[model samples]
Target: MISTPPPDWNSYVQSGIHQPNLPTIQEINKAEFAPNVIRLGTGELSPHLFPRERMKQIFHRLANLIDSLGYEEPKGLLFLREQLSKYLKTIGIEASSSTILIVSGALQALQLISISLLQRGSTIFLEKPSYLYSLHVFQSAGMRLFGLPLDENGVQTKMITKQKKRQNASLLYTIPSFHNPTGILMSEERRRELIDVCEQERLI
Candidate 1:
């Protein structure tokens, strides 16, 4: 059940047009199955962990801004990006506010990458049994996904060459820090080698 996309979307997205839906979510909406449905699907923060008072004050300040009600810049609020840039720099990520293009959430970012960056039939290399494998966004985009084996450290970069030969991988998506589901973090050495390999392969 699919149709052509609106003209606003790029050809890459339009070419792979398919009806998108979460079957499990639809089933949940249709029936009540469990009192405590464990969601092992995505990386999500618990609502109980939120500091309500702190968020209330933050939103109160945001409401006072003159342009708060208006549509935000495509890149996102500059002030927020500037603050984020400073925070990332403190953690050794050298980035600027201008370079930070914000999206609503990880799902939005993935979908945007699929529509804007990924082409139909392009291959994406990722971790074996990753949360990415559970997502339909890439599949819906008509992109082929391949999962590489992982160890105690992280993905086996040694397999990169073999996987590349099997498929033309244009993108390598990874959750290096506190990876979802497995909760394993990639070692610094492994991270460096992975980056070097990606650079050498001209992967995004």
Candidate 2:
């Protein structure tokens, strides 16, 4: 016969406050019975694809700058900012270095945008089956979210057109090119229509 554990010890062990869910990476590494774990769940690029030689040179250069190290400007490194600005211009986004607020990645960029723009109870529009991470960010910001369905072209612009007739939407979040999951691109006509709707609604 086996002895049962104490009630208080059981309660303590079951308490979720102290024992939360592990991060995806940690959980993946710790799993005892995973078979051929091709982890496409995380967005991390494969290590084999990285530019190892160039990264080594970049790290060496950054280490050399330690003597002049100070709190970087809130935006980020000026050289990187300028380089990003030039890159964006090449893609037709047309932005300046000063306008950029460099964050760690797209997740941080979405969080910053949500925090800066959303107010509690404000409504925002999103494409159906959108980025789960961005949805979480907006939810944490206390914004009301509504999903607009998508099709072969892109987000259902008809929904936006309809929404404009009634309540004001704070923002419209979309992945216009190579959309996540669906991998569909927004047509030029739809892009123009979206811009026009945003302009008409004065939402931007």
Candidate 3:
């Protein structure tokens, strides 16, 4: 049998509307799957941390309980959303099940927000060294990301007002607790200030 050569992946990636993942991210994605490798600071949980037995039991239970494998509601399963609401309450977020939209994952949630909420040419304020920079979710949707400097507390709220007015920024994306890459947890005072700033500036 004759062999066929694979298409040029690099060309496809270059021509695509969505920007490619950062080189370091690409390396991390591939390296994490390699045998005997320990991935630290990556998005996914470690393999060793997975509850294999619990997952098996849950799957078995689900197999019996769930009669149909048909499509779920746009917001996802009701029970899951209810549970998430309860969980969020514990963390001081008073979200109702009706308000909650359960996405497949964080990336999907980001993509949904990027495309649905904001208009083209909208600006987003984010941490200077954010995980969002590695992904072009907002950028691909015709929005811009303006990075704010971070300190021990978290992203500098002081800069937000000026930047918001200057760039006409519409949204602020933050990982307050245990921020990605840097791992700088936002202080309670900082969180309050951020909320205040957002309210005053009318930034979401």
Candidate 4:
């Protein structure tokens, strides 16, 4: 049997260099030369808006359920999942707790999906000028990234058609409603056409 080269492992380690530093709000505010800074970089909600007393009470109740905190299920707390299912059903989306895979956040959700569905050299269609972090995630997964241009109404379906003509695309990644960065929503007609195209192309 031919010898395989030692796994090129170093290539996969995320480069720590060039990473930006994130200072806490208090630290930044305390700086001697602090300018009028309005932070829009992070997605944290306003602290003032959080119901701290209610949250404390909820946590206290949860802590009292057991002597020591137990390892939560990998999928997440079953009660939370059931609650989410009920909430989704209220909004007309049919979902079940068993079918849901709870993630820490949206980034983890995307990462998990990418690892499960994508392969090295697979082509992924994304909206032009889409979320930078998502683009980075796809790059890390070794996907061949392709862009579909957008207009006032959102991602131009015609661009997707043209791109598909040029190369075989595996999946069309979209935000559709309140798209990140641009916050543009896809029109109903475009949404219908996109669904049709996906069905015709057999892309999930």
On a 0 to 1 TM-score scale, where does candidate 2 land against the true structure?
0.70
TM-score-based ranking? 3, 1, 4, 2
- lDDT (Cα, 0-100) at 109 in candidate 4: 80
With a 3 Å backbone cut-off (N, CA, C), the pairs that clash in candidate 3 are none
| Candidate achieving the largest lDDT | 3
- TM-score for each of the candidates: 0.72, 0.70, 0.78, 0.71
Candidate 4 residue spans exceeding 4 A from truth:
1-36, 52-68, 89-95
TM-score for candidate 4: 0.71
Q: In the order shown, what is each candidate's alpha-carbon RMSD? A: 6.3, 6.4, 4.6, 7.4
Tens digits of per-residue lDDT, candidate 4, 126-185, equal: 888787667766776667788888888888877776778576887888889878767788
The lDDT for every candidate, in the order shown, is 0.79, 0.78, 0.86, 0.75
Stretches > 4 Å off in candidate 2: 1-35, 54-71, 86-96
lDDT of 1 by residue, 37-141 (tens): 655444555678889999999989878666656888999988889999999999999999999998888767887888788877888898886774335778877
Candidate No. with top TM-score: 3
lDDT of 1: 0.79
**Model 3 regions lying over 4 Å from their true place:** 1-16, 21-25, 56-63, 82-99, 132-134
For candidate 3, give the lDDT: 0.86
lDDT of 1 at 22: 61
RMSD (CA, Å), candidate 3 to true, equals: 4.6
